[model samples]
Target: GGGGGGGGGGNTSHCAALTHIQDCLNLAFSTLDPISDRQNAPPAHTGYRVHIHMQRSFASNERTASSSSSSPSSYFVPTLSYWCFIPGMAFRRLSAYRLRSIILTSGTLSPLSTFARELYVPFPIRLENPHVIQNDQVWVGVVPVGPNGRRLCSKYDMRSDANYQDDLGNLVIHFSKTVPDGLLVFFPSYAVMAEIIDRWKTNAGSMASFAALRPSFSNSGDSNSHLSSLSTWDRISRNKFPVVEPRESSEFPAAIEEFRNRLGEGSKGNQERRDEGSNGPSSSSNGAVFFAVCRGKVSEGLDFSDRAGRAVIVTGIPFAMAKDSKVLLKKEVLDQEARTQQAQIVNCSNSNKGNNNSMSNSNNMSNSNNTNNNNNKNYHAGNHTHVTSPQPNSTSSSSSSSSS
Candidate 1:
């Protein structure tokens, strides 16, 4: 991603796009060549194919989009992607044949047919289980209209707006106080999260008060002061930047140890203290507020059970970056494949119907051969009869989805 005619021109504008492409290339080349080190090499039994493709990425400028006087402008970023392809048989060994059974699941698996074909599962027994949790356990709300009556949205166009940040920050502060323990707030990307955090810390005074309510794990529950109260986070942020001299290597681990001590969730000391009925400042204080990025490590397979997590706040739907070269190519390939398959299915259906019709005609012609001399002409005409090919389904274009 890069600034699209918004930021100052030249190097700064290209930085984001360059960084993304560089990271992608690094990953590709890391495994591209066979190394002498056994640990670094691909499995000996696996067969692999490498693909290189050039993709044009256009940066989406959110600030420009929100401006009524100016239209959104995009800057083209050329990217080269290296892809590694392992055939379905490789996956089949581990998932299909190797495993006793396989279960594929997701919260939004609507239009299940697409998944069936993509996963190569010929006949899938799709099960959409009814909600086990009560309706009250789940809460859904739309973004409110702005003071000027413009409908609020977290789309690319609106996210950078000052009004949007204020609205979102207010909501966060509200939920932080009203909601119970262990609230998980997810942002679309780290850049967005960092920007919001910076704004809240600098501009929004309410956020400071809200931050004070939660206990910090930077120290060993000894500090109760507001800024100091956000101890673990404070130390992490300090370490990340150079406002002050960085601490020794032991500081991070020590800070983490202090954090675990407060959570009473991980180490033996905290667990033991919890069993002893001592309401340590960490345990007795208000619960944790975990800020995470969508699709990050926290959102993967980890279960936040019991008191660990009470509620989750998703600021917006996390859509894949459209301008990313690899992303665009993958979507294009899937859509093309879907259309091809649909056309093939239609052609096969037409062929089968035509064959049945010709068989019937041949039978009738044989019967009429004994009576009419023109029966041969009729048979030849029936043999020469053609059926127009079926057009590809119109809906296939929109039905394709990103590969899992």
Candidate 2:
């Protein structure tokens, strides 16, 4: 939503969860693109489901929230209490009329007249606004790369160019020369993550980068990796990232819980053991930066509050669209539903005449955006050279996920 265009599609996890939501609606999702279960299948419904990402340009203090039955199913609920963070400020402007109903649910919504002008909505709809709550607050942090650093390939697939300089080593060199003290190393696949750890995992050999692998507990318990051998997490607790915010699935949840217990209320568990007493380098030889391949479900949604995750190497475009095709279908179904709804609204508006301006219909943009992401964006297939050094004022470095 920045500088005008946001083609970044939803991730595997994001899309997957949205599918489950579709299932709840009892809406049969068929063909979808980027990675479709079927081809050329027409959309079935006018009302559809859509998903998008929240970038700095379109960060919202407002969102669309729905109420469900007290019973729970196989879906990821916000805070397990139906309370979730819905930042939809951008959408409200795009179709102020369509978004009016959604934004009215929030009293303290950042007033639309000003935003409407920025977005150029067709019609204006004002209603009683609900108070925007901020109780479930979390801290967000950012850190800069050290002098002379670079992006690497192993960050994409450790199994591919593992040694950092194996193939795309030049990318790492192109970016920065100095790896940080608390280095977080990310590998693409689990096998790749293991490959790198087996090679550079040790305290004696001057353990520079701390390798972050897929923690069993961090998973959604619905993955095939759930049944695999997982002895890597034990290593992380000893000298790894010192255990930050852990999800409900990790095996060491008890250990993490105990540490967070010591921290009193909310914590990154407890870094007391990993922390330097008031006057150390305030850093760690833990490499200089943390490294991890975006493997399993190690990093997503969860908060990395307080500390700075300085260098975040996405080790490849998270996961592939083909990894799960059902979401693509569900995504398509949502699109169809939305299109059908738009048609319905248009038909109704024509039928009801101008007397019902509230029956206005909006075009389908959310679907088209995601379809693009599911295809071209995830894995760039071009002459992508390796890079490093966060390009001065640049925070989002293009993660090199080019296929050989």
Candidate that would win on lDDT: 1
Tens-digit lDDT string for candidate 1 (328-398)? 65666557556856987999999999999999899888877854554223322333542223236743222
* Tens digit of per-residue lDDT, candidate 2, span 69-118: 21112222232111111122234334535443433333233665644442
Worst 10 residues of 1 by lDDT: 239-248
Number of backbone collisions per candidate: 2, 49
How does each model score on lDDT?
A: 0.50, 0.36
Cα lDDT for residue 21, model 2? 84
Which sections of candidate 1 miss by over 4 Å?
Answer: 1-79, 83-111, 124-126, 143-152, 204-263, 268-284, 322-327, 357-361, 370-404
Which candidate number would show the highest TM-score if scored against the true structure?
1
Cα RMSD, model 2: 30.7
**What TM-score should be assigned to candidate 2?**
0.31
